[model samples]
Structures are given as C-alpha cells and as structure tokens.
Target: MERKLAAILAADIAGYSALMEVDEAGTFQRVRAGHQELLEPEIQKHNGRIFKLMGDGLLAEFGSVVDAVECAAALQRGMAERNAIGSESNPLQIRIGINFGEVIVEGEDRYGEGVNIAARLQALADPGGICVSGKVGKEVGSKLAFAFEPMGDQRLKNITEPIACYRVNFDRGSPDRVEPHLRNGYPTHKKTSIAVLPFSNMSGDPEQEYFSDGITEDIITDLSKISNLHVVARNTTFTYKGRPVKVQQVAQELGVTFLLEGSVRKVGARVRVTGQLVDGRDGSHLWAERYDRELTDIFAIQDEIAHAIIEQLKVRLLPDEKVAISATPTEDVEAYTYYLRGRQFLHMCSKSYMLLARRMFAKASEIDPDYARAHAGIALCDSVLHSWRYADVSIETILATSAKALELDPDLADAHAARGLGLQYGGQREQAAAEFKLALALDPDLHEANYFFARFFFEEGDFERAAELFEKATQVRSDDYRSAVLLTCVYLALGRRADMKRAGLLGLERAERELTLHPENSSPAQLGALALAYLGERDRAKEWAARTLAIDPDDLNAMYNIACAYLHMGEHEPALDLLEKVIPIASVHRFWWSTDPDLDPIRNHPRYKRLVERTTLASP
Candidate 1:
C-alpha cells in the first residue's frame, strides 16, 4: 500500500477519431504498427511500465523521470523518420504530457492525481509537442539539453489548482527559450508563500516521534530551497507542533499564502504519511495526499512529499532545487535513524539533551563516515553546549569537530555556522564574520547563523547592525527568549528609550510564556528581569533576578540582569559588585559592558575599569 513517486506519461493519438472515420482498416493498421514498432520498444528500452493502453494511446510509468521524457522525445524523432521514409502518407502524430508525482499503488494499478495530472497535461499538449507540469519540469528541466518554452499557468479541466506548464521545444526553427532566473527581492513573483507545520506523530510510541519531526523538517528544507517561494524556518514552524492549529490563523501569523499540515505514523518497518495543503486566504483545501512506504524508503518519501508540496505551490524551481530536495546525508537506515534522533534532541535546547544529541550524531557519523549532516549535527551540538555554559569539552574539540564537518561538506550551512562560532570564540573576528557570511549565503533562512552572527556584531559595540540581525532572528522565531533578551539589551545600549521599551516588552512576553513550558529553566527569569528593568519596574526586576539566581546560583546571565536592574535603580555599588562576580566566566563577552548607556552609572567606578581589563587579558 506504500505510495512512491513515478514519472507518469499520458499520450494520445493526434487525430484518432478523424483518422478512423476517413479509413477505418488503414488507420487501425497504421496505429497498430506505431504501437508495436515504436511505442512498445521505446517503453521497454527506457524501463517504463505500461499500465493501460487505449486503442489510440497508452499510459506508462518510469522510475527515472529523465528516461521517460527522453523516451518520449526519441519516439517522436523516430516517428518523423518513418514518415519521411513512407512517402505516400502524412505520419500519425501523438500528444504527450509527462508528470512526476506520487501515485497510490493498489495492487498492480497506480491511482491518484499523479496519473490524472499527466492526463490533464496530455490534453494541453500540441499534436507533435510535449507539455510538462512544473512537477516534471523541476526534475528533468536542467538534466535534459532540450530547450523548454514557458507555457505559464493554465487552469486545466477538473483541476482546481492551476498547473504551471512548459513545452519541450525540439523543432530546429524555434530557438530554445529560457526563463529568466528568479532574483530574490522584495515582492517576488512567487506570490504564493507557505509554512509547513510540523507533522503530527500518530505512532503510539513516543520514540518514533522523531521520524515524524524529521519528515517535517526535511519537507521544510526542500521547500525553502525553491528560489521563488518564501518558507518559514524550522524554529518558527515547530512552535505549533502538538498544538491545535487553525490554518487561517497560522497562515496569517506566519504571513503565508498557504499552510501545509500532516501526520506520520510508523509501525515497525512501515510508515503512513498524510499531508494537505490549505489556501490561507480562506480555509479551503487545495491538495491532499497520503503516502505509505517502508521505513528504508523514508528519504525518498521525504523527497516525494517536498516535491508534491512545491508542485501545489506552483513555484518554478531554482536550478539547484532538484538536487537540494533529493539530497540525503546517508542511505543507511540505521545511520539516518540516529541522525534524526540527534536532530530531534538538538532542537530541545537543553544541555543533557544536547549531550545525547552529540552522542547520537557521533554514532551516525561513525556508521556512515561520508554523512555530511551527521557531522554538521556534531558541530552544532559542540557549539551549543559551550555557548549555553555547559562546556563539557574544550575549545579544540569544538574546533576539530566543526572543521571535520566543513571538510566533509563545505556547502553545509550548519557546519559553517558552527565553525563561525568556534572562530569567534577563538578571537578570529574577521574569519568568524567570513564564515557566518558564507553560512548565510549557503542558506539565507538559517536562523542560528543570524543569531550567532548578531551576537558577534552586538559584542563588538555595533548596536545598530546587531539590532537589525536580532530583529531578523526574532522575526524567524519570536518565542526565542535569548534573542528577545539580547535585542532588548541592544536597544538599551543605543539609548533608544522607545525601541528599548518595545523590545523589553517582547522579551517579557517571551519570558513569561516560557515559564509555562520550562519553569525550572533560568533563562525566562533572567530575561524577565532585563525586561522589567527597562520598563521601570524595579521590584519585579529584582524579584525575577533573585528567582533566576536561586534556580541556578552559578547563573552569570542572572547576575548580569541583576546588575542591569541595579544600574537602572541608580545603585552603582551592587551593579559593580555583581559584575565583578560574573566577570571571570570565560565565554562572557560584552563590549557594551563599558559603553552601554544602561551601565553608564557604573562606568566611572574603580572596579569597572579593572573588570574590563581582566576580560581583555582573558580574551584569546
């Protein structure tokens, strides 16, 4: 019952009914000769499965989409050769539409829109030409040397969603027409934006949850690679996981034209996945499909789901979109399983989970030495652990793992981001910036790079640029308290009272919301204190700071927030006293510690100068 994507080719004779009316016996002979001499041989040669054969045409499926399209072109060219040799007749011609999509397999027959779309495409094809949906074009567009003419968007019969079409130009007189590459800018032509919600885990076992989440992330990653579409980052999308989502509301919140939601259930070696795309403007279903596949085919299933979603979005694929969507770090199911587990635990943002994630990533990389993503996961785990102040490993370990990841896959954005953070910590500022820039260039939607790079910018006393990045990071994931808290401080440093208040309230709201999620966590209390300090709530600021310190006595972030509160209360002595206590933490870096307006009351203090000097001396 597992559904797999196949290239469906629907073809029909150009004038079958008319040909039969003119000369029944002769037409039947001509058609039978074309079917046997041309169609069947080409189908067999290309490894195509002919599922249905009408008297005039046939429906075929191919595992390789490239082979299907090539076979069709070859068939046409061969038929032309026959017509040229047979001087008495105008050769019989056929119309074709090739589509790459998911097909539901019920016994020997394939069902679903995968075949239906091809049928619709066939109706649109010219007598001697082929029409390919965006779905098929994305897979074989750049792979084939044949030029394609843009057919634009067509609302075909019985198809609710308009199909973006292209015609393969094989004739010598028509020069191959190439569509202009979509340059990313404001108000892009790709008007239909979408946010794919994290797929729900329908499996009863909690451990299989990562499988569902992994599928969701893979779909998001693939969708994001399409140059035309705007896709929300994983951080923002997963916030709604396990929560009841109102599609229209989510679409409005995410500022998307569509919302994709689904569920995944894996039992033993098999999995069932269901997904639906909804139009955001009005809560109406646009496309829905179900995929049942064995566990080993998870990567292929992911590619299919991503392709299906992109097809529904009607986006013209970028030149690299096909490769990006199809790429998998490892073919080994066990290694892939371990990698998914690593990714699942990594996103939880806890030190113990991070450690577990690191171990899982190491195991995955060990099993598949060429696994680029597993190496990237290891790099991220090392960086997050150190940055979160649970530095179980040394700087060299972090550097080595990050370097190994980059060596394995220089194009991996996560590796570049991790290496950037390592270099930033190692005192190579310019090198760190270059790495961060490269990471962003590799994946502009990567929020980790934006967050870490913003920290690097903010720490160097560039409040304006730092604010810009923090704004972007928070936009990507507003519930991230660390980003909100830091953004609040950046505004404080720049002495923008109105902006500072706004950012502080944002921090306060995030911190307060997080209290419900992780009450024992110290970050919420620390952020709450900073937020209160800026809003002129001295008592609340002091209380939250005290609460944070009580939760974790070694919480330098709490101490810093307490210092900020004291500074606002005009108590220079205690602010300086708190600063002196936390100054020795090796990972702490605040160029604004001396220059920030909020810290001005303590800047002239004798202890402040010594603390700054100690940081300078300790910095590598």
Candidate 2:
C-alpha cells in the first residue's frame, strides 16, 4: 500500500437503475458510448487516469487538483451536449465530484477519506452538475471561470468529520443567447437589447469632448440598470465614435434590436442634449427628446433620456431599478466633471495618461470627499500603473483606496471591481473572487471586471475559461485590442486552431483600427506584433515589434511583449536580447514570465534560465 496526495474524481450516472429497468440493453450501450466517446477521452486529455470503473460509475486520479476539476467540468459539459441531441427519453446524465487530499493507493485502486468525500459529494450533486470539496474550490477560486455556490459543511455518509463543499456552476459553458457567429441583425434572446452610440460633441470645443462622452456613458449606465433591458457595454459602442455608421449596420454588428443616437452641447452655464431611439429592424424612430437646461440639470437630462427609452420600450422597472436608474454618483457637478475627465484617459495604456488620469480623479475626490466613483477611479489607476510596470504602487495603497471607495458607496460596481483587482494583486484569492462576482452581479456589462477577471484566469493557466471571459470582454469592448490579442494567445494555448486564427486576425484588425485613430500610440503595435506572430506573419510581426520600440525605446512593457512575440516567431536571439534588457527593470512581472505560454518555446534555454536567476536577484 502507498499513500499519496492525489486529486480524486468520482462520477456516477444519474437514475441509472431507472434507465436500466426501462431498456437494459439500450442503457448499457449508451453508457458504453459515453465512456468511449466522452469520459475516457476527456480524462486522458486532462492527464487523469481512470483507476477503477463500475457498471454506472468510475473513479479517476489526477496529479493536479486543477486538472481534476477541469475534467469534471468537461465531463458534465460533454454529457449536456450529448443529451441535447439525444432522442432517448432517458438520456444519460453524469454527476461528478472532485477532491484533493491524501489517498491510500493499493495497486491501481485508490481509497481513503479523499475517495469517500468525493463519492459523497457526487451523490450531493444535482444531475449533470459537479460538486467539489472546499479545498478544491479554494484552490480554483480565482483560477477557473466556473462559479462555485457554497454548500456549507456536509456530513459524509461514512466519514468521521464534516467537510465543506461547493457546487460548480458549469452551465455557463457557452453563451445561452444567439451565438455570435449565427447572429443575423436581430435580438433573439427574448430580451429588449439596445446600443447607445457615443454622443456627438456639438459644443464646438474639442476640449469639451469628455463632457459629451460622460453624458453618453451616464445615460448608458442609467438604462443598463433596468433588468428587462440588455444594454451594449460602453466600450463596444464607443468603437463607433467619430465613425459614420448606419443604424441597422450598427445593430447587426452589436446584435441589438434598438440604437440610441445622441449629441451634447455645453457652453458655460447652459447645456443642451438631444437623443433619439431608433428601431434597428427598420430604422424607424421610436422616441426622440431634447432638453436645454442649466448645466446643474445635466443629471436630470440623463434621467429623462433613460425614462423615455424605457417608456418607449414598455419595460417594467421595479422600485429598486427605478431608484438605481435615477440615482446620481455625485451631487457636485465639478467633481463629476473631473471624474469624467479622469475616465477619458482610463484606457489609454500609457503611463503619462494614467498619471494625468490619477490627478484628475484625485482632484474630483478632493472636490467631493464622498465621491465613491472618483476614489474607485484613483484605485483603478494605481492598479493599472502597478500592473503595467509604469510606477511603483504598494499593494497596501491599492487596497486602502479601493476600500475607501467601497466604504463610501457599498453598492458601487466600479468600487467592487477596483477592490477585486487590488485583492487579486495582494494574493487574497477568495476575497478577490467574491468581489469580482459581486461587481459582475451588480453590473454585468462592466468591462473592467470582466477584463481583470479574465486576466486572473489567464495568469492561472486556465485557458478555456480565460478565453470565455476574454470573449465576453471583447464583446463588451470591441475596441480593446489587448483583450482581443490575449484571446488569440489563449486559443493558441488551448489548441483551438481555427479560433486562434480568427482571434489573431480580429486582434490585428482592432489594433490597426486603433492605430489609425491614434497614430502616436505604441501599445497597439506592441500587441499587434503578437497577433501577427501567432498568425504566422513573421515579417509583419517583426516590423510591428520594431515600430513599438521606435515609438518608445524605454517602454518596458512593450519590450517584454515584443520579446514574447519574437520568441513565438522563432527569433530566439533577438528575444533573448530583449529579455536581457528587460528582466532587471521588469522583475515585478517574474510570475507572468514564468507562466506565460508565449515564453514556453525558450523557457528551458540556458539564457532564459539565467534570466530567471537574474530576476530573483533583482526583486525588491
């Protein structure tokens, strides 16, 4: 007998006895088909070995808890897909349970408390669902994309002590609505969907563009609070900024039923806002409104637009929803103005822009000491600065600022997201996961929450879920080249060749579009190089890499990313050269370097090994 720490996976067919009694031969054959086609293959794919098999159940052992949990999800998903097309009245459903603990192994058989806990958990699972021990859940809390509903402490049938458990929400395997590729210029999800286009800056002063953008975002936020509506995220709609796009075309691209077009003009104390909602199906105006009022009435104007759209659509808003829609982030318009200005630079991906954004946010907070969103903005700026290696930001500072934001406005989704990012950076995985979940629950279309959560999964090497989150982020923020490019890398790692190509091409297209809009920005080129390299356009990738370096030779993030692109393109020497230059100053990202699959090709190289050694010595 040998005792070892192993991840145990136990699975059994639901209602097996009933199915067998109905049609013994058919049930057996279907079960065999499931084992042959789904179970065995997925287990092997995830590096798990089936140690034992019964008539309607099996037990497997994996070296990693991650692999075991992933295998359980795959098993349940495969069964769901199979059952979807099955004509049988009694389709086979699998209930899976996974646990990580010490197991007593005896010649191809695993036993002990681990196995017992897993079996008990499998019985606790609903048909076609997975249940995992608290240990497994904690280990995978932030790593995987699956939502875990806590089951509290459970008393196992034969176990001495109770163990905590969680039910994995693997039902979110794919989009429940119309698939992206199959969408054809219509809202098919039985929800009233709309896209709010960026309001035109009719004020004549280009410096006032931020004000118009802020008005547009506020209206979008107001409408989004209505549970009956499906609002396209701000980032996705902003991609059409300054572009002459037809309403129907925009609807087709965004898969929305309605489009909101607007313009804002502000001169000193007076402000005018005009908005119209059009039926995307036929390009007919459903509602139109214009409000010319004092600048202090700007918030009222936004609420009016939201109410008009809801009334036109006949959406029933609950009391809470009504309050949410009408609520303002700040009473002070000056603070609000400064906050909007800060938001203008939030996604610029440059240190100078981030610094300026931070200053703007700080000014807003100074003006209104209780402006929760401004504090959230400042926290996010610090998070990004630290993440991008642009500045040294203490984890304590990030946590404190985000905490302040949450304390000021407990329900603010942005505050939750900011806190989540800081908690993730501080290595409080469970707390971070809860904050992210809360943020998404409050505002499902939040780009920052989806993007940051996707980054967490990507860093954890959970490529499948990371890809899903990235896909969601891309849908929300179509102009976000970073998420698009990272999606390509994730698909590449998952061996989804076609998806990789599609994502890589899409990333390059978005990056080029961004470059056309902002020619001086080098971040697009930095990411575009990776997309090009993954797509096998070696020369173009190298050119883009050189372009990034030319734009800013001192940009460590660009240098590191280009090094990855070079490694992917099989240009080892230049990749090594860049790594040598970047490793010392970029020591903060050593964890990323260790985990990024892009560096796998040269991970074992002597020079790369030496660079890893150098990183340890350079760490603060």
Candidate 3:
C-alpha cells in the first residue's frame, strides 16, 4: 500500500433520484452518455484518472489541484450549456467538489477520509457549481482565474472538526463575482499586473539550464512590451527558483495579479514545452498548453505560448506586443542558445563575466548578423565597458556599436537603454532623456531603463519626476539593492523624514550584507557611508567613507561623501580641503556636483563657489 498527495474531484448529477423516478431507462441512458461524451473526456484530457463511478457520480484523482478544479468547472459549464437547450423536466446539471490531501492507494483505487470528505463536499455543492475544501482553495488560489466565495465552516456528520469550504464562482458578469486579479492580497481590476516565474528546466542535460532560463527571460521581455502590464522583472521572480511555491505566494511576493509557469525539455533537435496561465488571486488555471517542435522552430513555440496565454486572460495584445511576439532573432537554434548563455553571464555583473558575455554575443551575431537581441547585447557590453572604465575601448567604437544595433532593430529597447546611458555620459542630456523615454515606451517593464531614467531626472534637478520613476523601477525589480539605496537619497531630498528613515534602514541593511559577502568590493561600503551620512550619523558615516577610500582611493562618490559629511558637521576647513581634492576629479569625469542636494549647505560659501566655477570651466 502507498500513500500520495493528490487532488480529489467528486461530482454527481443533481436531482438524479427525481430524474430517475420520472424515466429510469431514459435518464440512465442520457446520464451515462453525457459522462462518456463530455465529462470523462475532459477529465482525461486534464490528466485526471477516474478511480470509480457509482451510479450518477464520479471520483477522480489529479496530480494538480488547479487542474482538478479547472476540469470540474469546464464540465459544469458544458452541462449548463446542454441544460439550456433541453426541456425543464430533463435539464442536466452537475455538482462538483475538490480537495487536496493524502489518500491510501491500494491497487487502482484510492481510499481514506480525504476521499469521503470530497464526496460529502459534492453533496453540499449547488447544481452546476463547485465547492472546494479550504486546503485545496489555498493551494490553487492565486494561480487560477476563478472567484472563491467563502461558505464558512460546516460541521460534517462524521468529521470531528468543522471543515472550511469555499464556493467557486466563474460568472464574471455578476456583481457577486469576486475578481480573480489580485496582487499581495489586494484586488486589482487593472490589466497591468503580471509575474513570470522561472521556467522549469526539463532538459536532461544539467548544463543546458541557461537555455531554459534565457527562454523565460525572452518571454518576459516580449510580454513587458505591452506597456499596460506591470511585469515584474527577472531579478524578483528568480528569487523563487528551485523553491516550492504556490501561485498565490508568487503573486503576493511579486505584486502581480497573474502568473506564468512552464517547463522546457530538449531532446537532440526536438524540444517540448508545457505552459500554464494562472490567476494569482484564487489559484485557478486560466489556460494550459503543450508544444512540440524542432529546435529551429523553438521561437515559434514561445510565440504560440504567449499568444495563448494572452487570449485566455482576455488581454487585448497591443499591436506592438503582437509584433514583438512574432519577431524572431534568428533561425539557428545554436546561435540563439549562445545568445541566451551570454545573457546569463551578463547577469553575474563583473568585468570578466561581461567580456565572456561579449564573446558569446559576437558569436551569436556572426552566426546570424540580423539577430537584433545579440546586436543589442554587443552594444550593451561596449557601453558598460566605457561606463565602468574597464577597457580602453574608444568612445567612437562604443557609439558605432550602439548605432549599428539601433540600425538593425530600431525598436530594440535594450539598445535604446544603452544608447541613452552613453548619451547621458557624453553630456547630451536632452538626447539621453529622449532615448530613455523611447526605451521605456518600447518596454515599460525594463528595469534598467526605468532606473537610469530616474537617475537622469534626479541629475537634472527634477526630484518629483525622479521619485515617481524610482517608485516604478522598484515595482519592476523590488530586490534591486541600488534602487533601494537611491530611494533613500530621493526621500531625503524631498524632506520626507519617515520615508527617508525607512529607506535608509533598508539601504544600510542591504549594503552591509553585500559588503559582508564581498569584502573586497568598495561600492557597497560607499553606498552604506552615504546612507549613514543621510541619517545624520556623522561618525559612522566617516568610518565607512574612510573604508571606501582606503579600498579605492579614486572613488569619486566616496570622496564626495567625505566632503559632505565634513560640511554637515560644520568643519569648513576640512570640508574645503576635501572639496579641493574632489573638484579636480569631478572636472575630469564631468560629475554633476552642483545638482547634488547634499552639497547645498556649503553652496553659498566663497571657497565652494570658487571651486565650482574652477571645476565647471575646466570641465566645460
């Protein structure tokens, strides 16, 4: 004997006794035919096994609770449509119950209290409706597009405890219909919220994990182009990777109303993918599909899945979204895989990793020169190298690469984002803002574009707009440490003391943990120092600032922090001396010193005014 957790679906024909009394032979014949022609086939198609059938009822087992509930709803809907056409006396209807629990399996049949409870629940269900146990509702809620109205706790005859029950409602047109679109337990009618979880790697080879991960990211990028959806970025969704997650939990954590989960398996030249669209409010399956295709046609599979999900969710795909879904980077599967691998490496965020990423992108482009994403990757790599001063690549080379990427695919959001950053650093402020706006228009959920746009606004002294963009960026990538830290600065600038304190604490915690992990990196230490300075903790701020300069003496931001701390402490001589050191470096790098509100206190000082004039004239 073995025991396993499964979703138990129990259903029976409503008013079967009365119908049988009216016409025994005719009623039995119709009931049997309906089960065979409609209900049985749907159950089997949804991967449910009929364990037993007693007169006008059925007991089935399903691997997924969501599938079980969805199958039951489909069966009930079908029966409703059939009843609408028949005479009132012969009207057909079904009552369904679903529960998730462990059951004893002896041979082909399952037995236990779980099975009995499901049967009792079916009796409680209204005709053409479903009743689910509390446990089942919890697991499937947030993954399915159905409403669950609480029926309160009921005292079952043989059960010791009162069983909590919920009634499944699929009638979206009714006022009592509970909206299934909810994020973090709040109902939202807006179509702009979505979460794409990491796709399961069903590929036999463990090394091919990057391929599956890359495909998930590509789909996310395509969907984010819709602009109306608040798509959570990869960083936030990837946090649930390899973890046991319920659809509702994912929705809550990512602040998204819908969830997309899928698995990819590759066998030689052929690939298979299975995907499901789930309502994150009540754990209901909206749509599910399986695709089998040659490796060369893998892109088609992704497009088909996206289209199916959008249609099932009743989302009107914008013209841009449709175009984005249909767009193919390359026909060669190998080149696409390389491009995906490059993206994975780039996420590691290191100089060496970026160089390797560049090589892979170059290889992908060589295999297919018209692969827009690969070209964009190349442009981004070059731009990062120039920004970080990690390579001796000339500005002309960086600009030329970005231009080529844009020329190949003018609508490529990543290329636009990279070009924007390049332009901003090149002193073309208006051009940079335009490029950033274009990138956001192309992909509203592109976290980097939103973040850099906020940075651009903040640098241009538009604090209000910068704060709004920063908030949007945080929604896109909630766990982004830099964004959290930047929010602290924004709150401080706006004089929102409570928000400033909260943000400062968060930034300090993240920076301290990051520094603990990578003791050699000065970036987190510098950020921590700035956070401390903002919090008015002068001594701790000075300590971290000293540590930052000790690690990287040329770190201009750290030097600025030191000068600011002295200015705040009213140590004018020391502050003037530190500013003298930073002014020359700021001049060389064209850093925006005047726009920084941190230095406002000393702005009117003759020494500071002179230093600003000297730095601006020399740099300009």
Candidate 4:
C-alpha cells in the first residue's frame, strides 16, 4: 500500500434503499443516469476520478482540496436542478463530504482515516448538501465562492479525536431561498448553546425525583429566556437522567458549548442545591456553587443558579429577560411542589398518568387559585385526556381553565398553547391558529406550541404545513418520538417516500432509546410498532404490537395506533377489527379517522366505509 495525501470526496444518495423499495427498476435507472450524465462529467471536469462505488455511494479522489470542494458544490447544485424537473415521486438527492488528509492507496482504491472521516461526514451532511472537515475548510478558504457554516466539534463514530465540521452553503447569493442543512431534520444551533442535564436526586428518596427534575427544567426555562443564549430543551437534556455520562461526550452529542449539571436535595424544611457549569470543549469548570437554604427559598436558589450561569457566560440579559427569569410562578411552595409532580406525570404520556397529572394540577390550582402555570397544566391534561378519549372532561372546562390561565398570565407560552389546543378541539380553527401563532411568537422553542400547531395542520389535511411543524417539533425536543413518528404519516401523504422512511427509522430509533429507560412504558412500543411495520420489519412489528396490547389490552390510543401498524404490515382484517373498537370511542379528532393515510390500504373495503360512516353519524 502506498501512503499519500489526497483530498477525498465522498458522496451518497440519501434514502436510496427506500427509493428502491418504492420503485426498484425506476430507482436503478435514475441512479445510473445520475452517475453517467451528471456525476462522472462533473468529477472529470474538476480533475477528479471515482475510485470506488459502494452501492448508493461513491468515493472519489481529487488532486487539490479546491477541486474537491468546487466539484462537490457543482454536483449538489446539478442534482438539485435535475430533481426540480424530475417526474419521480421521490426526489433524488445526494450528500457529499470532503476531507483533506492522508490515505493508504491499494491497487486502484483508497483506504484510511481520511476516507473514513469523509464517509462519516457524508452521513452528517443534509440531503442535497455538503460537509467538510476543518482541514478542508481552511485549505479551501476564500479560494471558492461557497460559504461554510460551522457545525461545532463533532465526535464521529470510532474516531479518536473530535473533528471541527462545516456545512457548505450553495445558495449564498440567493437570499430568498432557504436550503437548510439538516441531520434527520434537526436544526443546527450556531450560537452560544448550553444543555442543563437532569439534577441528581440527592434526597435519598425515590419519590423526590420529581423535585430534582423540576428544578432542572425550571433552570432550563429560565436560561432560555435570554435571547443571546441557546438553552437545550428539557426533553432532550432529561434523556441523560440517571446515566453516567462524560462532560465532553454529552456536549459533543448535544452540540453545545457548555454543560450544567448538579444535585438537588430537600430534607424536611431545608433544601441544598449544588450546581457546576463546565466548558464542554475542555471539560473545564467555569463556575460552581452550592446553596443551602430553607425549603421556602427554593425559588431563590433557582434564581441564583440562573444568575450565576448568566454572569459566568457574560450573556447580556435584557430587562424583560431578567424579569422573566427571576419571576416565581407561585408563592406557595406546596403548590409549586404539586405542580412539579403534575409535570412529571404529564411527561409519562399515558392515560393513567394523564389522569394523575390532572388531579395533581387540580390540587395545585385549589391551593393557589391565582397560579397561572398550574391552571395551564390542568388545561393541557384536560385537552390531552379529552382528545385521547381517556376521560369525560368537557370542552367547556378546557376552554374555561385555559382562559383563566391566560387571564392570569397572558405572556405565558404554555397557557397560550393550552388555549390553542382547547380551541382546536372546540372547532374554532381560526382562534386556535391565532393562539398557536401567539404562543410560538412568545416562545419559538416551546415544544407544546409546535406539536399542537402541527396537529392542527395534520387534522386539516395540510400535509406540507404539518410536516414542517412536526419536523420543527422534533428538532426542539430531540428525544420526542411522537413528532418523528407522525412525520412518517405526513411525508407518506405528500408522496415523499424517502423522507417517510427516514422519519420512520428515526422514530423507531428514538422509541427504542426510550424503552431502555422506561421498559414498561407501552406508548413507545405502540409507536415503535408503527415505525417498524413501515420499515418492513413485520415480525418485530408484531412483537411490539403484542407487547403494547399485553401492557394495556383496553387502551383506546394504543389500540388505534397498533391498528395503524397492522395496516402497514398488511394485516387488513386485524386492523379493521381494532379500528371497529376505536372509531366509536374516538370522540375527538374524528378527522384523523376519516383521513389517516395508514387506512388507505383498506379504505375501500365495505367494513372500513361502514366504520367511517358510523363515526361520522356519531360526531356531534
């Protein structure tokens, strides 16, 4: 083997397998045409040669880093133009990664860390985009017209050291167009970012876990108020709960500059909170503090932590941001405690948990009638319970509680989101849209706002809008599987077969991760079954379906979701049987029954038509 320094360019068709599954012969022909008509000519024109082809991907070597970078940009631009006019249902897009490093050349092919880094960077690139290591970025800097967006330090799989990466932006001259560089639809933050991991429960009681979790979430929320700082959402950060993690590893995975982790202990009438902020780049402590105070000073402790972080980071807090950060939700510590427990239950995402969460929120409201966040929590639980057909909560009650929340704190994003959900369920689409818009305007990163808004669009059969919002929801809360799973339906409806398959794969991956943490939580299994069936894992899908059913034989939401999975797996009779039981109880979101893409396989069947008609007649 001859060792040489070369610019390695790796390119692959995104979701090639899914495209082939939809139309085998047509996909093959498209790939061949792309290589012959576009790829080969572009590489040769830029003084490069394709050394190896790996099914849907190819590895090419260029003499200069400039030629490699320029060739990648041109090839991607060409693919975009061709796909713009293509008649195929699935658009053909390629992701490229370029690295300038040493390679071991054997015979006619290249092998080494250089080629490996290029391949991994290709996987990190967005479909129809390019990613390059810092070496390539620096070597080709200002030598080309293309702009580069830094993606932070990424720890690629099996690589010893972290790599600085950048995404190649092709539309630098076109201000009106937005060609986003995404990794599985998750947006990259190019700002000062931090993730606050779940605080350790040092109270030595399992029941006190909620207190620590709540403290972590509140600190995250408080930090998020600063417009200059990008705070990772609770859903994504809490995934690290109870796990032994390395500071640099967590930062690399989360793509953040800093990590905040600590412990919370509450013993009788006293509370001790210890927090430390670490610079993820070098795992150096930027700040550390411990607060020992009365239980009633919990809010003060949270405020001090938030202020310490702000001061350490030198983030300029606006007047409104400071007020928002230090503001206490409730004066009564007991009410706050109950509200935190309610939030913990709400995150469980089950019928029983929803009921328990609602009761806890109700108790909090009863204790402090003017507590806006508590009332907002009640509205959310009621909306979810009523929508899932789990409880007999009236729409009037949802509207009243949400309205009371808004009356108390109109600027609260959760209150507006809860109000919007209530209005959407009450058949007031315009008002709901307004509420959703206002909620998002107040807090663009709020998961509930994005999730509820996406549901509104999905029910209206606006697949394009729904997909965009669902993708945003998944990005805001990286650990959420529901939005990713729902994107499978929206993408399928829009005839984005490759996107649909990618979403299903991502949803299943996240669901599997959730199962590792909460093995008995059947919601993940229920959703995972649908994603599995979409990916053509029939037996595994059936296994997951059986597990979900065994966990809750009479759960309406589980039965409905599993029925969708059954349809995907070609079990029409069983799907129809489950739908027969679910349709009658689906008092809310009747439109989901009428327009679900999963039911299209059996839509024309006599039994399916009858079930739809029965639900239509039963609808008020």
Report every candidate's CA lDDT: 0.75, 0.81, 0.74, 0.83
- lDDT value, residue 18 of candidate 2: 60
For model 1, residues 439-524, the per-residue Cα lDDT tens digits are 98897657788888998888876665677567656655646666777776787777676767777777788889876666776767
The parts of candidate 1 lying over 4 Å away from their true place are: 1-195, 201-213, 226-259, 265-272, 279-287, 291-297, 307-323, 332-357, 384-396, 555-578, 604-606
Error of 2 at 187 (Å): 8.4
RMSD of each: 21.9, 15.4, 20.3, 9.0
Error of 1 at 574 (Å): 5.0
TM-score ranking from best candidate downward: 4, 2, 1, 3
How many residue pairs in model 4 have overlapping backbones? 0
Q: Which is the winner by lDDT between candidate 1 and candidate 3? A: 1
**Backbone collisions counted per model:** 1, 0, 16, 0
Q: Ranking by lDDT, best first?
A: 4, 2, 1, 3
Q: Evaluate model 1: give its TM-score.
A: 0.61
lDDT of 4 at 386: 81
lDDT of 3 by residue, 1-620 (tens): 69999999999887676577789998988898888888899999999999999898999999999899889988987887777787756687888988889999989999998898898788667668898887786677577777664444543435567686667776645543443533335445334467788899998876578888878988887776664555656755775777889898666544457899999998889998888988888889988888888888888888887777677767677787778778776888889988988876664344556778899999999998878778778877776665555556765666677788888888889889878877776778879888998998888667778888888877765665676577556545534455666777676677766666766766788688767866666767766876787678888988887887787776554565566555555566776787787664556433333544666677699997888787778662
C-alpha TM-score for every candidate: 0.61, 0.66, 0.54, 0.68
Q: What shift in Å separates residue 595 of candidate 2 from its native position after superposition?
A: 5.4
**Considering only N, C-alpha and C atoms within 3 Å, which residue pairs clash in candidate 4?**
none
- The CA root-mean-square deviation of candidate 2, after full C-alpha superposition on the true structure, stands at 15.4
